[model samples]
Target: MDEAPKALQRFLAPFMEQLTQKNLGNAVELMNEDERNEFDRLLGLATEPVRSFAPYTF
Candidate 1:
């Protein structure tokens, strides 16, 4: 259960490193600050729990 971060890092670190290594800053710069903030907010919400009946099932 606890290895999630390591597993994610293993999968994502290379892509992130490649992005930095390749300097994808232009794509990043294309997004306005407000858009970036909104995207981040949506991403955080996406990672959070939503109302569901699954937990009550037996």
Candidate 2:
């Protein structure tokens, strides 16, 4: 059971990274000040591993 998730995660890792990258790009291009702040707030709670994917900084 544990290995199953690891296997799945390994399989999906590349696609998830690509999608997260694209979404981060789009968020930067489209967000206004208020929206960006909201995004940053939400970002602060994201898991440390992927939070660096955030494309914006205060």
Q: Write the per-residue lDDT of candidate 2 for residues 1-58, one digit (tens) a residue.
A: 3244445445344435656465455545565677666555545444234334656754
TM-score of each candidate? 0.34, 0.39
- Residue 19 shift from truth in candidate 1, angstroms: 14
- The local distance difference test score of model 2 is 0.50
Best by TM-score: 2
Q: Which 10-residue span in candidate 1 carries the lowest summed lDDT? A: 1-10
For residue 42, give model 2's deviation from the true position in Å.
0.3
